[model samples]
Target chain A: MLGAATTPAEARAAFRGGAVRPTAGIAAGYVQCNLLSLPAADAFDFLLFAQRNPKPCPIIEVLEAGQLESEVMPGGDIRRDVPAYRVFRDGELVDEVADVSEVWRDDLVSFLIGCSFTFESALLDAGVPVAHIDQGRNVPMYRTNVPTRPAGRFSGPLVVSMRPMPAAQVADAVRITSRYPSVHGAPVHVGDPAAIGIEDISRPDFGEAVEIAEGEIPVFWGCGVTPQAAVMASKPEFAVSHAPGHMLITDLKDSDFQVP
Target chain B: MLGAATTPAEARAAFRGGAVRPTAGIAAGYVQCNLLSLPAADAFDFLLFAQRNPKPCPIIEVLEAGQLESEVMPGGDIRRDVPAYRVFRDGELVDEVADVSEVWRDDLVSFLIGCSFTFESALLDAGVPVAHIDQGRNVPMYRTNVPTRPAGRFSGPLVVSMRPMPAAQVADAVRITSRYPSVHGAPVHVGDPAAIGIEDISRPDFGEAVEIAEGEIPVFWGCGVTPQAAVMASKPEFAVSHAPGHMLITDLKDSDFQVP
Candidate 1:
């Protein structure tokens, strides 16, 4: 079970010991979160950014200044729980570190955001095919013409992750994903890419592109990459985030957010 | 259609001309919102408070500093739209005004929160009898032992509005109200009010108490009065809010939030 842990605590312990990697497919039934930590000065604006654009930046938990253990995740440590972390200084990637203890500061506040993996799992369980996963590639993502509502100094175009499914199952897919509002909720756009101002479907701004078969339509959901895009555009002096593909798995089950 | 106008624009016009009163049951189908305004300096903490305790402070729209018109409500003016406004200074009620224009400044941030009347109306429409309405009294409310997750300088106990409903109809009532998450959503506590620190079912901390029938149970939902409670507890230098029972009618329909 070295690469396959069943609980978030076990996963975090492995991560803390420097014996873990990308968290997808691990902790299969648990919730995995995208991490974003910023200085207290910018925390308000970043939180406001998330509030204004909840679709792309659905907040799972926000830690108070200097606090590391998550309110929602028991025994979760922000500094050492994640397998990999990326540091940003003035909007540029400065370092990739396994643990941020040396760079951690008392003024830093952390935010745990919802990851799309939760909904993707639900989609797969409902018999909907995910093209990128079927091809063993990263999900296709694109920068859209749709602008996010601005908050303080944080504002940028929305970034979305796309999955292609047959036109007949689009309604079912929407219904399934809508149950997980905390995990990016329903699709923002479900049809043609050009309608949202994407020039080409083959080349994505980030992630690998996938094939869309005949009678299939491109479905887009708000991606967690949005906050990072906003951070890059705003150019804050310092920030910390989980490395791409490396997530912090929490103790809560994926089905916990299925509201009545 | 003097009193039966179904548009927010007409309602606001009437409010501005000193012709309108409490907004409940005025624009029958449109959404009505609770208003809160604070200086720019305190806006961050208040917004964080609302974000942390979403059940009680489900924000419908947030206006940027010095901005008057709501992003969600087209052509709505914050200063003159609400029939009655309450000004609080140092956490004490200081003035009740029709127009806040004289006191409005360039550093004020306004927020529109969902009102419970939206869900109450839905419950009534679904054939679930509301005890307070049936008895022509205000819904009872209580200060619970449950404390809201604190954010920034804001922290306080949870305040809940109570309604007594027959046990047989509780499930249907919950289902009907769960559709509107932005407007105080589903009940926080159902049955055995004492479990959540209510000692007396016959008395309430706020509003009028209604009789709980022999087969009925006391159900509680997070109340919008929560944010105001936080404001009072934190003792901010200045704040503005809609007078109790007086709300801002928005153009959006109540059914717009009915999700899958």
Candidate 2:
């Protein structure tokens, strides 16, 4: 749910005003993040988990107990800021809701994780064509053999998103994305999927698969959805995440995260 | 105490044989790290602290409790690999020794942290002159107003190392170092040092001060010594660290850590 507005506050207001939809392609220059809210008791462990596995869970901001608004993203409310949210209880999908205000707890901690959407914009600006966006579909994702470091009870195989591009552009794509470490920066796997235990590239465990043209190499990046998978596997008492494709928009400009 | 050895294994062997000297310029191209060995009781918390504050404590490898050698760095023994060791009891420096084998306990966990020396070499190779290296002295460091994200009992002010370079080379220096996140990627602050709470650039809180020319700007990088400072402040019952400049050399090459 978005308008011609360029500010994060405006986007949040639109979402709060019954505009329930995915957040893709909204507020082009700003950052869109993945949301993860968990109990305070589990906060430290989860934060450590994210830290140990930064490529999968690059934290942008962490909200303290009972704090719904982020100090980093001022005036942004977590309760109703995201367009859509998925609630999980004991690791099972309980319901998809527009707002989580009813079940909000004072002891809950919220984490804003970097999404690939920021770097995807960078790739596009650098003349690197993204296949999924061109085909009007979700980027292909797969469960790889790569194991994530276990922190407390959180541990699972890494999840990666795949994009196919020419060998020459791969280097340029890497250079552009590496500047934004807050997002999943650089490719995790560059060539064959079989090397990482992916049997067929066409059939993905998650998201729609895109065609890999001749002379194109399949490149993979650590996915933002990895923490959600970890939470599901850990089976925490309660967890909430932005629904797939739906994201929380923040006031931070993409350029603010650039290294130089 | 170094001899005509050209390999990391040889360097470790020399150190193990009672070498108590600075590791600067030795074992060129191999990765050298700052060591932090603490009791198992504080292992998780210390790791969390490092994860929460990666800019200062970029973890290269973590050895489990009671483990000395690392799979990541083969044939290297932690107990006597470093040129020198400093023992701290209740936050007080009790002793500095060439080897810690006698005091080594089964409950101790080792953390290998990225040192700024790695990136400094990268900067110099990129033709960005390092002021401290040119003068044959330690890089100046200062306690800053920037606060680190506290985890468990570990927290303190950020300590940054300074290098004076012309304004034109700042961008290139940032780009080159940013690719090596394992080595305190990029400059944390540039231009005004007073903004970060540095009272005097001439007299540093740690290390030797170098002359900052009129056209040059003082660039600050997150230092590896930050964890030692935090550990000292936290007053842990038992802790160990490599003597200043007496780093632990690993088999990893500097190019191995580049993001692309």
* Among all candidates shown, the one with the greatest lDDT: 1
What docking class should model 2 receive? Answer: acceptable
Highest TM-score, which number? 1
lDDT of 2 by residue, A1-260 (tens): 36535577788888877688777788888888999999976776687688778888988877766777865567767988898999999989899999999988888888899999989888998899999999999889998888888866688889999999998899988888777878988778899999998999999888899989999999999998898889878999999999988899988887877764
What TM-score is obtained by chain A of candidate 1?
0.95
lDDT score for residue B5 of model 2: 51
TM-score for all predictions? 0.94, 0.83
lDDT of 1 by residue, B132-180 (tens): 8899887788889999988878888899999988999999988988888
Fnat of candidates, each listed = 0.35, 0.15
lDDT of 1 at B243: 83
Binned by DockQ into CAPRI classes (incorrect, acceptable, medium, high), candidate 1 is medium
Which DockQ value does candidate 1 get?
0.58
Go through the candidates in order and give each one's C-alpha lDDT. 0.86, 0.85
- Residues B90-204 of candidate 2 have per-residue lDDT tens digits of 8888999999999998988888999887887788888999998899998898888898888667888899999998999988888888878789987899889889999999999
Clashing pairs in 1: none
Question: How many backbone clashes can be found in candidate 1?
Answer: 0
